[model samples]
Target chain A: MPRILRIAGAQMGPNQRADSRPAILARMIALLDQAAEAGAKLVVFPELPFTTFFPRWLIEDQAELDSYFERAMPNPDVQPLFDRAREKGIGFYTGYAELTPEGKRFNSAITVGPDGAILGKYRKVHLPGSVEPRAGDRFQQLEKRYFEYGDLGFPAFRGPAAWHAPVLGMLVCNDRRWPEAWRCYGLQAMELMLIGYNSAAYDPNGGSTENEAIRTFHSTLAAQANAYMNATWAVSVAKAGNEDGSGLIGGSVIVDPNGVIAAEAKTLGDEVIVADADLDLCRQGQTKMFNFAAHRRPEQYRRIVDQVGAQPPGA
Target chain B: MPRILRIAGAQMGPNQRADSRPAILARMIALLDQAAEAGAKLVVFPELPFTTFFPRWLIEDQAELDSYFERAMPNPDVQPLFDRAREKGIGFYTGYAELTPEGKRFNSAITVGPDGAILGKYRKVHLPGSVEPRAGDRFQQLEKRYFEYGDLGFPAFRGPAAWHAPVLGMLVCNDRRWPEAWRCYGLQAMELMLIGYNSAAYDPNGGSTENEAIRTFHSTLAAQANAYMNATWAVSVAKAGNEDGSGLIGGSVIVDPNGVIAAEAKTLGDEVIVADADLDLCRQGQTKMFNFAAHRRPEQYRRIVDQVGAQPPGA
Candidate 1:
């Protein structure tokens, strides 16, 4: 029998503002226990899994802001959740707002080993929203005001498991809209892509109604493209529910190497979606039918770097 | 002074069944004349520029099909268009339905040099729609029945004027949706990418009204990503108008090396969009902001080739 990696997309409900760290930890521990019980080798949580997507509101005070962003990964309060996952022998992906030591901040994700050691860290690359307050009817998405641009580039690392297979990547909510994130990871030949998101129900521009199915389909389409193009398994999880009157749609999915949806969560609750994926499938897709490298021609793409406008200040 | 390529986007209108090759060729020649008048080095036309987007409707008769697909590129009829472009000292990119000698049919694009020589040919890689008939309300796009999947992989070629400077590459309509097309060409250092498309009005599946602007945005976004990621200039032209009552959206655009829309056509007629692109800008972008080659990790991508499925029979 071919060795299979049993991965789970842990789709959790909203982490309300009133929810404390211990309460969230208990909930996360329960999820890990459930995933472990279901024999999942890995479980992926959504972006800002511990709290609400706080960047939706604007903030000016420094003290109140520090409360939202974490100073360290395993700081005393969140240590138990890591310890529980290690105890459960299940690796996981979690997203958070990181307040760096250098006084800069970033929206980031962390992949932790079954032993609770940090496997890899990825900062969100494509930051959306305005840096300063805007004069518009659109809901204030202060991501740019809250977080600095990512300093950590695309980097994949080996996960701690019996197989010791390399599963390289990351994706925050909005990063899925951009192809560069997947391209960067695909160029790295990332076997497993972990993306977590907290997408709002209302389109700030008021384009389409908050259709949950469409959002889910959109997520699946992106996953399908990434899987087919890069020959990697893309697992995306979401935090869904009415968080302080704002709805976050949830349709967590696990896409196989062939761009097929192997398993997906149905309800908006704490659910673990598991699927057995053969690592060899990704290798097969890349080298055979969709062999991008073998048929690639880089010479014609030399114009991609040609600058159209004057270079920005400081080179 | 650095060498620059002045390319023109020949945004064409509808080409109905009753519309003869002479009529279409006349429009193309006019566009070439306009491009030449604008001092453009090359002009690009849309996919299957001579016929209605036939794949939108299913057809099975072999004899009826033979009338639509072209047996040759400059087959007596299209020769005049080429002759006119050559006479005007301008290169051109045009899409056509090809019937190969081996009995295989393909939706292909050809790059014609100023001297009327065929510079390069590309068969579209991504074949959209079903192979067999589907029982549904959706407008069945039967491309698989009409044209075989492309065998000629993405290949970039050196144009007449620039041998070592920039390699030119081609992609057809649906191929724009896939990043592999850009990446494949990017790897070869393709300096200029010419993509031609003819998108229909209906969503085929009857989901939502086809957003031509969004589709156009996708093209520009793809061009921008490819340009920023690979440091290449991409010019995408389209054939717009209701052909036999099927409305086609036209948003032809010329994107420079830094992913900026340099010039664009507003009308869905025989419009000529010209823009000057510098080759040195590509080198600068690659060496600076979008330096994927220098910072990219290939070691992790070893699994990309190791995972292909078994080759299809008779390979």
Candidate 2:
């Protein structure tokens, strides 16, 4: 299919806990307008765009915790975002904390068509952060404590492009860091992959003394590397800047199949990085240099298939 | 066992067609001397270090074709390298064309202990280039026509260091570009990964018009990405510089578990990139951030095991 998808990675500034959902969605709409003005057919927003990375903090009160979850995607706060996308005839990918009617909390990202209909949804499969709260830690990265592991596997959807729609898939935050997470979309032969991340400068490992820039470097590196390896166009957006005193690394990026960063956002504020990505160009790498069909030796690799050695020494 | 091996990636310039095995071995010896002098316990060399990139040309004569493969590892010409390494109490990794007594041919790399004993061997699995020569091309890459697919799947070696030896695995040339190739080593939880390559500046896909620097970028990108994702130390050495009439890209690099380039070769000629890698640091990414044992999702990933969607739309 002949496809040229002009896409944008909309990096959002920090969302303070005091900021209402309307305030965040209004900023998303502004970014959407900028992306549309830049001739972007689709724009991808950061993970939990409506919240200030709520999982970074540990809350004891149940009422305060429930306040972080989105009861429905198009609740009054987000309907305007859908309205703006429809008006501009632009598709978008956005992430948020989803709480089901039964009160099951899951980290989710969804793709919306230009007509404001949901195309597909993916949960954050490779969730980061420990469940136990470390006393001395700068931030409580108790993601596992706040939300459950995403039940949804990486799923691809037919896109909202004008014609010759590109295949699309969704990944969130830490999922972008794992090569295994991107492999599923690669297997589906996805043309464009969207990932939303909330990367903090806080090093849970106590390894990095460098500023938030370390996460920015790693975030862009993984995005470009996965795109090049899989022969797919990947867009990574982030909730960057300091939020509630926690500093975040904000380097949202768009990478082509050659591992080249085509367009990248420089600032730690509301920004839109746009580039016209010819999905057709992704074919050369696939057909010539990296023909997975001809080159991949799946049968020989029993380790990944069997999960052999994917265990600790005594376990 | 406490273990730390000071290693070097001994990058070499291409061997001209007129160059003798003695000439190539002499250069390798010089590089090894520099490595040993620099306190390196192990050194790694490029694929087919003793010969020019022979697959770039097509030879119809059987005698002329057979001349490219080495009859034995420690045969007269390369024995000097072994003798020097043993004398210096240093181990090394080197790649070469192997011809079995039964007339089998394979592109292989072997790990040698300080005592000049073969610790382990691996044959190149992901053979690149094509059998049918594409005429009017700058350089022909018909490796599939010359060498057989490596029989040895990426194997792990347990020795070549002091007590508490680190696990080692080998990859040759084009094999470094494939994620599938690196996964096997990562699955084995290899402490250190060795790769030797002969990368030509020529582009086969007719896509890149840029110089050899592009290949250098790709080589380093893949190396760092694989190491970071798998939490292993990866060293890539190359046969660089203009060889014969064709130019090769050289940027030998060593990347740590954090996907940071610890050391890199500056020139396209014979150069040694040395680094002292602390083996223990690799554990944090494995045990904390990456934690493959705790984080890998094998159950949902049926495509890899069943090879589903691996093939193109049709056979």
TM-scores, all candidates, are: 0.58, 0.94
- What overall lDDT goes with each candidate model? 0.74, 0.83
Interface RMSD of each candidate, angstroms, one decimal: 9.9, 2.6
Best by DockQ: 2
The number of clashing residue pairs in each candidate reads 38, 0
Off by over 4 Å in 2: A135-138, A161-163, A204-211, A308-315, B1-4, B135-138, B161-164, B204-210, B308-315
Measured with C-alpha atoms, the lDDT of residue B212 in candidate 2 is 74
Q: Cα RMSD to native, each candidate?
A: 12.0, 2.6
Q: How does candidate 2 fare on TM-score?
A: 0.94
lDDT tens per residue, model 2, A13-62: 99999998888888999999999999998999999898888877778998
Tens-digit lDDT track of model 1 for A108-137:
999988878888898886676667776664
Model 1 chain B worst lDDT run, 10 consecutive residues: B306-315
Question: What lDDT does model 2 reach?
Answer: 0.83
Question: Which pairs clash in model 2?
Answer: none
